[model samples]
Target: MAANGKSRNLESFVKQQLEGAQKRFGDLEQEAGKVFRTLKARSKGQAREVEKLLGQINSDALLENPKVKEFGRKATQVSTDLRKRLDGLQTKAVEAVGVASQAQVKELNRELSRLSKKLDQLLPASVKKVTSRGSRVSAS
Candidate 1:
């Protein structure tokens, strides 16, 4: 009975920790998403402003300028790099929290089920019956 109570308490503690980790992971994901969206919006606004400035200038002259072309290339590269870094940060944060992905959880469940079935097949019916009944009887 004491062992059963201890097991139950342990299970409850583990469940609560898992829940908290999942919640924190979710919050991190949301924060990352918001930051990405904000970055995208700001980039778009800047792009529009650049276009407006180009319209105000001599388009043919500015477009032909090497510096202008270099600036555009650098801006694109920076944006791409920022996005990649943000994605990496999000992935690291999730991993740091020890939260399993859905696919990973499903695969783990499948493996556990397979192992349980194999165990059932190996164990004798009598042993299975006793073990199943024994725990509840002992708890009582």
Candidate 2:
């Protein structure tokens, strides 16, 4: 009897914990999506600005001027560096989300293991009670 009660309680606890984990995972996934979208939009805007600068250089009458060429080169390098940084940040964000997901899974497993142990400890007494009660009822 005690074993049955303990098993039921453990089952309930496991279910509750899993539900909470699912909620947390969902939230993290949504947040990651948001971060990706934000980064993409920012990258697109920067790319557009770089394109416009290049187009301006092409239109300028001083396109052959040394200073103008140097400025254009510097602008290109800056844009390239910005792109690399953004790419790094995006990669890091993805890795962080993955780590978070793994951690949540580990936590859920630990909780489940603890609950199972507790149920195991309670089971013998529960069975004994149920068997005794059944015998008494039959005798009566």
The candidate that wins on lDDT is 1
> Mind giving the per-residue lDDT tens digits that candidate 1 earns over 41-93?
99999999989987889988888899999998999999999999979976787
| Model 1: lDDT of residue 122 | 70
Give the top-scoring candidate (TM-score). Answer: 1
Candidate 2 lDDT tens digits, 18-104: 677577668877987998899999999999998888787755567878998999899999999999998997667646544335676
Off by over 4 Å in 1: 1-18, 33-52, 101-107, 122-140
lDDT score, candidate 1: 0.78
Off by over 4 Å in 2: 51-140
CA RMSD per model (angstroms) = 6.0, 9.3
Model 1 RMSD, rounded to 1 decimal: 6.0
Residue 29 alpha-carbon offset, candidate 2, angstroms: 1.5
